[model samples]
Target: MVTAVTDHTDHADHPGDDEGREGSGHARVEDDFVTDRKDVRKKDFDMKDFIKRDTGKKDAGKKDAGKVGVRSESRMFGLVRVEIDDYPEKPASGDDTDGTDGIGNKGRADGAAGADAADAADSGVSWDDGLIARRVSATAEGQARPVKEAVVDSRPPVVTPLAYDGSLRSRLDALRELVGLSRTRLDSRTLAEAGQVLDEATARRRLSGQHTVVAIAGATGSGKSQLFNALAGVAISETGVRRPTTAAPIACSWSDGAASLIDRLGIPGRLRRRPLQSAEAEAQLRGLVLVDLPDHDSAAVQHREQVDRILALVDAVIWVVDPEKYADAVLHERYLRPMAGHAEVTFVVLNQIDRLPGEAADQVLDDLRRLLDEDGIALGEYGEPGATVLSLSALTGDGVPELREVLGHFVAERGAAVRRISADVDAAAARLWPVYANRRQAGLTEEARDEFADRLADAVGATAAGEAAERAWRRNANRACGTPWLRLWRWYQDRREPPTGRLSVRTHADEEATARQRVEQAVRTVAEQAAGGLPTPWAQAVREAAVRGSQGLCEALDELAVRAGAPVGRPPRPGWWPVAVLAQAAMTILQAIGGLWLLGQVVGFMSPNLGVPVLLMVIGIVGGPGVDWACRLAARGPARRYGLEAERRLREAASGCGRARVLDPLASELLRYREVREQYLRVTGVGV
Candidate 1:
């Protein structure tokens, strides 16, 4: 018998479906829905097709049953769950109603069962298909939601390992600052090398923080290549008795993320390898970028050059030596002693110890340590054992684990590059200590500047200008406020010598020539004073800077002398000048009238009015003396005041020229000295 357990309940009418539809409209971003809507429609169509095919099969079974009306009491969610349920035999219409299955069980039951079997065969739907259900969701307005958001498993988050982010940022920042300062200010070639070290370190760190480069440096026949292969646990570098077996540096890294670092070291792609990942013991040595370098003592020039280049960039160095050449003078002179400050990253490997007796090997290692100590190599990390001297034989694999363990520790504990660069910066700072340290904080004192200004003032003829201005001012005053008779007398005398009682500019071609010489001497003296007690080279620099203005000093001074000392027009006439002149005019008019009357009396052209004439004469004569006295009194003070002002104006201009030409340049040198000192203190970490 065909039985269908279908969910006839419309999901659109389900409780909370209205809320779901409303929230879905708002919850899904419009852009996400727009792009994915077509796919959602396709899935919906496929699911609906499955639903229709299922319903058609059931309709055929039911058609056989309306003939046999068969039904079952079972519900499905979103899918039709089909299960055969055996129905009780239906009573014939004329016989018994013993069972109530709602369908007559006469002959239709057999017919419907047969039809259901045929439809099941045609439909080919079975429970074995992994997708046993076609899910349906209701959107707003009775529409189906085709696709549903996938549910993620709720679990604790998996923590990703953190990469190094310059944990020593401040210290490295300080060290880089020191390197930059030393490169610029320190004349010594050592600082340039230190700067190179810093640049390489920072570049490598930035490219990949996880990797620390280790260079296996050795002389001819030192077995460094063999050790490189041994440590990497694979023969990444060829070993031979031939001279300069390694022409270029060969990089063998334990980790996968050091490609950029290897590329920066100039290692070719063909020469790079991940050689130690297979070994469980060596797995802890990740981020160790080991290089087999060309022998430093190679006979080939290019080989030595390659060795020098790689050694400079690597974070740590392992010096490989044999018993036969454990104390080679060339290695000590060229590499070890000079790199003593780098002991934190330096290791002296006494290789080929298998050939020596145990005691003999120990003695050789001890002797190597003593030699390193004498070279001022402080062993260890910041006063701990800096350089590790170990005996390892690559041929026999003796003590290889110890070397590997030490390197692994180094690679694991971060900041080797920072430590190395800091040591180099320290070396650079030490070299510059004498150059910049122990300097005074004093600048050019005010007393010294004033003296320089005074010298400059004399050269520009300031004194002469002032004196001339004083006299010129007095003359101008007299012209405006003096008695008319006295003024006329002075004006007549002016033809011989122009009045000097006003502002005057006195510039001598001869004075300028002499002034130039004085300026040069003064510039030199100021430079010397500013450079006092400084190092010889810096002192010379200061002196040169101060003297640079000397080329144009004389010309500038001459220009200012003509301009500053020249009169700024005549001083405003004192308030009393107009009054005095007016009074003088009146008195002169009275005198003229009185004299004319007397003349008329003498010529007998009119009666001699004796009373009026005598009174006019007396009044005119008395007024003339009084007005003259008043004019003299008023003009004296005005002349003095105007002369002083004119002198001051001229002096001010001359002073400006002197400052620009000489004083300003000298101050620049002083500023330069102060800057160098501060930079030096910062680089050296000096408190002051």
Candidate 2:
């Protein structure tokens, strides 16, 4: 049997209680006990093995020893006596045990202990007590147990890192610093001062973290000064009846930062750099740096130069155009198209919109936006989609606030200048890379060169010279090698030598003309090929120059011949070797003829029968071979000299052709590309 007992430890503790119980050899088990106050007579116990026999009567006299206190002692009387503190003595219930009283009691006590263990487990204190009791009971009963499995978690979590580059304002600051460095290198006073103004503008932009520098760029009578005054909230810039009012840049700032920005712009103190008067004006401006640049279409060279220089360094440009000249080709072609990459940093303002009737204003704005879009600029974010069309009379102040607000928001965005400059430089670099880079050979092939040389040789009658030289060699051989009799016979044979039946004077002239044509055609072809792919104007110029050079070369060659006193008919068909061979042939023939005549005169009167004519014949034959060898040896010097002269002429022609056709065109194209590139770099804030 088992019973549960709840022990309130503070009330239950007794001093020296364990010492008092020690002599009985009773082992104390640390355990919690629970009991019900109403169940004083009977103990409801929990046990592993026990049988309950029901009894009819309630045993009021029985008490739960666990509710009070129970003490167990092993006595020499061979019995374990259990004592109860404040126990109400009563008879045990009949269900407490079987008829064997002591065994039943012992089982009830063990069941009560088990119940206490259960109570302790329910209270979340000691599972060990219950577990050990179960083990003991199991061992006694010879039962087996099952094994348990362990648990694990398998999934893991993921992590990421965060980092970013500088913000728009900081990047603008960096650009300003770069511009400052560029400014210090300028030599011209006006340009340097302009550079200083640009620096000041950049500094303001950096400090305020705003896109602060604004420029009014436009043609004469474009109301750029008026726009500037409207933006400045004051008529600081002179407006006109004058043809071109803003001769130099006029700058205005909201704060002290404006002075630095103006100074960096490199504009002289003649231009105003006024601070805003009121807090509201200051608040409205926050970080604005307005500049009035000179007219782009002005005839004055200085005015144009000023506009160009300021445009290079300004943060954002407001291109002002009057309704009358908004679509001018000069404005679009010269300025807009060339600066296509700066579309992001540019704002096209169709000023004097007030002059247009109400209905016409909207239409004009639409047209303007369309034009700007065609030039690759996206509008809006500065105001309405076509809000770039501000119908304001700087004279009337209508819509001026709207323009100011747009400018303010643009400054707040802080991206206009940076994006503009970056894109400009990138575009310029892309365009120029191919131009500056080494060009691949596409003009002349080696086979073509050889063909040209062959043509030139033919034109110059090299083959005809070769043939004539061969003929001369034969004549020289006969003269130099023959005996006197043979010489006489050779002279007779020469007189009978066949005429050139097909090779008439006309044919020779035709050949010479064909050779000249061939050489000229070959050189012209090479020059044309080299000049291919060049721009039309440059290409035409080069071609004209090449023609002139060719004409000059012909004249030069003519002059060289005249100076040398060489006959002007054509280059000699039979060259030096041929002439030498002919001379040798004549000498050989004369000797042979003399020897034969003398031999015939002395034949009968000679004592020693010397074969003078035969000896002369042998000498003639040997002399022919020696003469032929000597002619061959002598031909080398003249051939090399002529070849060298021909080479020099060829080189000069080639170089002149290249200069006129290739180098000139290439240089012009490259220079144009570079100028455009530098302008783009300056606008976009790129390093050299």
Candidate 3:
């Protein structure tokens, strides 16, 4: 339901204020009320439509929440309220104003009144008649009328949307983290790249805002100071006879904006922020923080350290390498190779070109370009073919103007140093991610494992164990349950009884030969699988590693078996049944002696009734011991001999796989990790 109420306080100013026209004026008021109510209803309808439209198109062009575009709106009011639709809402309380109210006089008035009322309520003010009378009087006098001054809230929007840059920043951040992790795990190039990343990140952060930091990097006696002087248009840095000069960093700046840039660099105000004599002396070079770093090949440890530290934090780098030392291994290995990715921000200067013969200058420049290419540096103008390599003699001021112009243009572009570092870090990280990933290995099929297991079981004398158990059970049963009348019945029962632990013995020859063959086959299959799909060099390495591992396993197993005192050779089959018959005869004679003694004892001299039973017991006990001793003696010789033979066969099998001691896989993996790490570090400008 809609309700309309007109304020009567302004009745005096109405057209029909006279008493005679009260009826018409009242009708007019009702009509105006209806029109206002219709307008409100229309606004409500529009709001609903807006909600539906927004819901329908929600996913049409959704971007990352963090990267919303920043927009600004200017309001006429002193208090400018920035409404951010995407901003998260805060809970409403008596002290805090809820911001969702529709924009109109009523909403504003109610909000303000609510706040004041809440304040009054907290102050223990009573809502009595006296207060009402005072309010009425104040209203009559226009003192209590709501103030309608337009508020201009200049606050920036809560949700400052960033431009949609295709998640480049996030990708870069991930890459940086990866590089950092690689630095911890590996060494060599990867580690160097990681250090470079850190250096760039630091430099970028340092050079952000209005600060300007310029670094001069070059080899010894390369006219760096001369170039520094040319750039500064003054003999600020020592040069000429004092070769390899500028052992320490010398910072130069113009009077204007000099203090600010120096301060940003954390250079103390005490360090002379010297002002140029001419008012327009630093006009072209305003905001330039020129730093003359030590020569790259200088022997001073501190000098090198300073060069490294400043290079990391500088806004721009001027690489001044002379034609002679440009191709030096120390320069390329120590710096160029590692900093190839920073080509965009790097300026390669071929200093002291005046020393070269006129005809040789062009050749040298070409050689420098070729060297840069070999170093993997992208050269030339933006979107052009190669890195920008300029030939200049700092001593002669030749090409200095062109170098200065390039520097000026570069500074004018004012790229984000932090962003660039972030990019480098991201790139380095992307390169190293594969190493940490869980590489999938080709797995053995279930059928293969089962086949191997079956082969192993057969080779280990499974059938022999079964036969031995059956024979042992039969022998024990026959000895325990035998009678003269039931001897044939007992034999039948023995044949029917399941074998226990007596069968044909597993001669060492059989066990060792079978085990050796099975193990060899298993090792060969494993080695083949490991070597498969690898490149030639890697395949050979894998094969060699596998062979070594297998051989070691074989030796270990053989050693363990030998220690267990297993038989090592073939068991003997006696050529004579006479030996067994002789042994039985000896047992019979011992039984007769025992029987005579027992008879003498029983018949007032020996025990007559127990003689035969005593004799049987003696024979049975003696016979079992003799057979057990004979079997052990027969098994010992063959077991020892064959065990060594099995070991030798396994070793031969391992040898067939490949060279058994070429390289340790674990150590090789670690070395590869180090190499990759060093490369990564070099790419990112991270030092070891």
lDDT of 3 by residue, 57-82 (tens): 44541332122211222211111111
**Each model's TM-score?**
0.57, 0.38, 0.43
lDDT scores of the candidates, listed in order: 0.62, 0.50, 0.50
What are the C-alpha RMSDs, in order, of all predicted structures? Answer: 24.7, 32.8, 25.7
Tens digits of per-residue lDDT, candidate 1, 1-688, equal 3333333222121222212223222232110011122343455344345445556677565555423324432222112322233333332233212221111111122133333233223233221111111122222223444333423233322322223344344444554665554454346574565566556555655665666889999999999989998887655577877676777787876655565667777876435654533345446787788888988988889888888887777788999999888788999998998888898898888899999975998888888888888888876635475887788898999988899888889888865766676676666667656655435644578777777776776777666676666667666655654556777786688788875744333434555568888777777777777778776656666677676766787777778777777466875666767787787677767777888888899899879786776667677777866877776676667666655665566556656665676567667656655666665555454533
Return the top candidate by TM-score: 1
Q: What is the C-alpha lDDT profile of model 2 across 659-684, one tens digit per residue? A: 55434543454454344334434444
Candidate achieving higher TM-score, 1 or 2: 1
Runs in model 1 deviating more than 4 A are 1-202, 234-236, 273-279, 354-362, 381-385, 393-398, 424-438, 471-507, 530-548, 566-648, 661-688
| Cα lDDT, model 3, residue 75 | 19
Model 1: per-residue Cα lDDT at residue 209? 62
If the candidates were sorted by their lDDT against the true structure, best first, what order would they fall in? 1, 2, 3
Please say which candidate is ahead in TM-score: 1 or 3. Answer: 1
When summed lDDT is taken over every stretch of 10 residues in candidate 3, the lowest stretch is: 130-139
Error of 2 at 146 (Å): 95
Residue 336, model 3, lDDT: 75
